[model samples]
Target: MAKNMYSLMLMDEVVSQIDRIAAQSSTNRSNLINEILADYVSFVTPQKHIQNIFESISAIIDDVAALTVQDMAASSVICIKSALSYKYRPTIRYSVELFSDNKSLGELRVTFRTQSAELLMEITHFLSLWMQLEQHYISKFDSKDSISYAIEQGRFKRTLMYPKNSSLHNSDEVSKAIADYIQMFDEILKGYLNGEYNTDADVEYRYLNYLKSGLTVI
Candidate 1:
């Protein structure tokens, strides 16, 4: 959305109320006013769209016992946390950040805070293998150039792409796709880390079956 500078005259009492609400919402006065005006005009601004998507994601994952949504004040980002079934029961965090621009949908970041060298090495290997699998499969649907992947010591990040079929500006479908993808990724990662998937072939087979299950990939 394009923004511009504008001058408006409002009563001091109204401004005070807007300020109070903005503070409560973790936003500034200008943004609160903008959202109010946008709502009044029924305009779906990028912020509003992002909020809708987050709400949809929350709804979709509400029944999942393994995933927990973290409280966030920002509208463009949602954070979910899940625990790994390892010896120390390390926590893994997944953060989804939606973009307002057209460059892409947004980014998914999976991060863990662990001091064990062995765990870090395992995570790195798993992330590398996961990236290769996604590159091999997702490229068939989207241009390989459109997707981005990165892996560090305890983090894996991927750029999300808009669904190829329907623009589906509606947030429900898009949010559901994202939520499902994260759940699948989390399950596979936990399994791999827990020694359930002992071989690369075993992991690949599981992933291929998931791809064949007709879930929308983004």
Candidate 2:
């Protein structure tokens, strides 16, 4: 386990309520508070970690253009790898079982969802050519669980929103989908650049440099 470093701030009212419940549960308020804090971080980071990873990547990219995946700082590396609880199985794993019927014990293994094998394989193949993936980015579609994806990318963006969300807070499938959506945007942006698609103001990713390569000032 890596070192967990961050400030702790619990609301006064919440602390008071925790004290009352702590007395009944035979647990100290601090212990309860810490448990809740851990739960929140565990439940939150995996999905949003990509943004934080990307932000760190983007910042260093200008100064450390030669930086490879291995060059990322330990903290960043931990944060990024912690997000890959599925694909990094064995070393970092998620368990799964498949059944011929709901009650029948058919198969079991340390892995993510089996229904996602094809998509997961697709992402794995794409990632093999890219940098060693630290965190997998995800995006969702209207169908939510049914149409989801994950993508391996060079850069990540956004940070503050990394620890807060409702629908995606505890769903791995949604994370996979979100990754796919981002990859789709990347593909769209690439196609538009290669003249495969018409250029439009509303580019999915809207990278001005990659979009037209003509936006700059003296």
Best by TM-score: 1
List model 2 lDDT by residue over 176-206, tens digit each.
3333323333454335434554434333234
Task: Quote each prediction's TM-score.
Answer: 0.95, 0.23
lDDT of 1 at 217: 77
| Tens-digit lDDT string for candidate 1 (1-218) | 77898999999999999999998889999898999999999998888999999999998878899999999757788999999877778899999999988567899999997788899998888888988898888876662336889888788899988756558467888898899999999988888887889888878988988889987778
Residues forming the 10-long window of minimal summed lDDT in candidate 2: 90-99
lDDT of the candidates, in the order given: 0.87, 0.34
Candidate 1 global TM-score: 0.95
Error of 1 at 73 (Å): 3.5
Say which candidate scores most in lDDT.
1
lDDT, model 2, position 143: 18
